[model samples]
Target: MLQIIQRKRMNLTLPRNLHDSLLKHAVFLSVCLPETVRDTFLVDPAVILIVVGVVMFFITFCGCIGALRENIRLLKTVKFSFNTLLFAFLSLMLPQTRSALEKFARKAIVHYRDDLDLQNLMDYIQKEFKCCGWNSYTDWSWNLYFNCTRENPSTERCAVPYSCCTPVPGETVINTMCGFGVQTQKYLDANKSIYPVGCADRAVMWIETHLLLVGALTLGLALPQVRKPRHTCRVCMGGRTSRRHQKGLTACWRSRAPTE
Candidate 1:
């Protein structure tokens, strides 16, 4: 009889322990998987860039509205949101900056093909030197074009003789003209300051910066705020306490009162 009782108790304890373990495992699995998936989605460069750009644009828009209305609260919110968006935008641009540097370096090498000495020097460095503790260009992009030479012989000299020239390829020239024209229209629509520079490279940079800033500010202002239950409860209690005090409630009674 004692053996039968002991066996039953052991069986009961095992299941309860197993149940507790499974519950804990389930909780871990639920939280960990979703977070991992979320991180995976967020790590994409295009997604991050778009998200930050949209946030910044909204915040800037709100800031403009606040300024026009002379609302202090709105202005403060706008300022905070703008700063946050700016930080995010900068973070997203880090990867793009690296990509741009790599692209530029590759283009430079192609453009300076006639300079065998420079090519040989680059090849030697690439083969022998490990930059940022990496054997290949996989680790660093900006370092690849560090102290590189510019294409133009004179700073004052214009590369293109005309708006449309053989020096610039037809497709590239068309794309530049179209992009600038579209951006010029956008500036006009917004009544914003338009840069006088007509050079393709300068114009492209300007447009990119403007677009990125606008997008980041916009999304920051529009993103929904996360609500914390504990915070909400505290706020409710605070208001109730203030109200009670206004009605001449004693400190002792308030201290002894149970929280709802």
Candidate 2:
């Protein structure tokens, strides 16, 4: 589980038959009858360990090839510093960019159940910020499980995710039902159980308040990217200069008169 958490993305090319075999094995593991092995195969510890092993092997092979070939692009880390800064700046300063972020946040909430990773990320964000959905707690209505429509069959209908709930002191175990039926309540009533402010507003306000820190971090990341190419050029020029000096000395030595 820890190994899988560390891997951001994975793609490996293999023979079609080998790939199909692995896929079939993975499917079998996912549906195994043992309660311990059932359904959660994607995050199973053994599966994660195997994935980590394969990833390590692939990376080691690539590193060896890059080193042998002296491929600067492959040896050095890929720099996205400028693009990252630009996107961050635009998201902070432009209304349209901010709107897009808000919409994305809301969409994540709407499809919260579709991806476990997304659900975990959303939970973390909400818990950290002490905020609810994108616009309001009611924004969760867009999720099928939490839909407020009369026809929705989910037991959690009209409820926000439990991440929105205010923590109660001395509670040993989390009440997963803490946010139950929150969307159905009046604003004042719901506020008692969960955060009232939207996550988008909280995030924006945080950025505004920490503008100096953000700027410092942006500059810190950008400085290395700006300097790296210049440093590489200097090294190459130094090598050329050394070679020219050595050649001049060699020519002078050969041309010098020798006494018998």
Candidate 3:
């Protein structure tokens, strides 16, 4: 506290008129931008999460109310909005741009190798699909660890991943060394040694194969809704018949009453 007082005492001061002018300007700013007083606070991770949580809560709350009330118009609006967003996402991910996907795959492997989840996903894709690299095993040449050159001088040079290897029966563990020097070899030898194609071609094939499945699922979802009105129409007709019969019985009893 004593040191703080000494530091303040040593602080330089402007002329009295200049000090007065600066003070007036500060007061003017405070009055003009009163709402920004707390805006100086840094937005940290916790604050970001809280904001996201609140936004999601509001959206979900509105959806729940719409569902319980059976508001078709509101539900349709929400459905259309969500579908539009999904369509946009699918448009971007579609296999139309083969070159773009190939480029993205090359960068994804190199930059995201340290990211465990992405790395695991790539590993699974390679193993499950029995493929390697973006366009071919040579695509690994762009990777620092796998590039076949003296400047880089890596142990993994001219090597594909173990996922590209053909599994030997009765082997509990993978032959990690099976892919070594396979990239530098000819395709005739490499065909027996490793997967010969690129991931982009395989991915395109997978998407093409599953398109009919996606269409079937979509058709299945829509058919139930289309058929729902048929069931409701029968119920509505039954209700009308019952109402008509009730009216006829009351009229018949009134007419049969003797001149009362």
Candidate 4:
């Protein structure tokens, strides 16, 4: 009888302990899994770029097909849509949109580890521009791992990424730890270790210095869209055009027409 009682207690205690252990592990995974997921998908610009590429290819393909088929309705739709996008892109230079762009830059820094491509791009920008974070070196604090908060558990807390570090003169190998604990120092002191300037200001200065080149590129891209549709429209209305007009339009479209 005593043996039976002992066996029953042993069975109950062992199962209870196993269940508690599994419950503890479940709670730990629940906390840690979301953070991994959040870090990965929080702000992936590559995905956005992929989506935009697919959309632009679809639009441009439709435009080319419409022009070839002499489909007036489809041609008009493409022209209108293209113009809308062009104007919208130009409007990004406006103050409100520029501010929004700056906000995006900050967010990009916050999620710097989310995408490898973005991380590499940011490192290149920082190294080439002699800049640090988006608005300032301190902007790295926006990243959870780099945050200086007392509650943060990251080993990288209070440190900047290696890309922000100033290169050593004539060093053959890169020093990954050069930026360690940089955020704990004063600006004057940290400036010795990392670039003090912000990438946003450097980018703006670059654009301003190359304003003419920027304008020329914009016009170059826009002119083709603007002129191609006019040629297509004239070709579609060939019956109304004089022989000279028809010949000129045909030559223009033939010269610049999109190939399949």
The best candidate in terms of lDDT? 4
Against the true structure, candidate 4 has what lDDT?
0.77
Residues 138-178, candidate 4: write the lDDT tens digits: 88877767877665556787888899998889999998888
The clash number for model 1 is 21
- List where candidate 4 sits over 4 angstroms from the true fold: 1-42, 90-93, 217-260
Query: Whose TM-score is greatest here?
Result: 4
What would the TM-score be for candidate 1 when compared with the true structure?
A: 0.22
A best-first ranking of the candidates according to their TM-score comes to 4, 3, 2, 1
lDDT of 2 at 5: 56
Model 3 lDDT per residue over 43-105, tens place: 222444688698567557667877868677767767776777578667875655676666557
Residues 44-157, candidate 1: write the lDDT tens digits.
345657897997787787788887686888789987876775786688766586565545344433322234443444444332321111222111111212212242222212
- Per-residue lDDT tens digits for candidate 2, residues 29-71, read 3543233323244433355578878856666666677676756
Q: Provide the global lDDT of candidate 1 against the true structure.
A: 0.43
Tell me the lDDT of candidate 2: 0.73
Question: Which stretches in model 1 have alpha-carbon errors above 4 Å?
Answer: 1-39, 82-260
Model with the higher lDDT, candidate 1 or 3: 3
lDDT (0-100) at residue 146 of candidate 2? 88
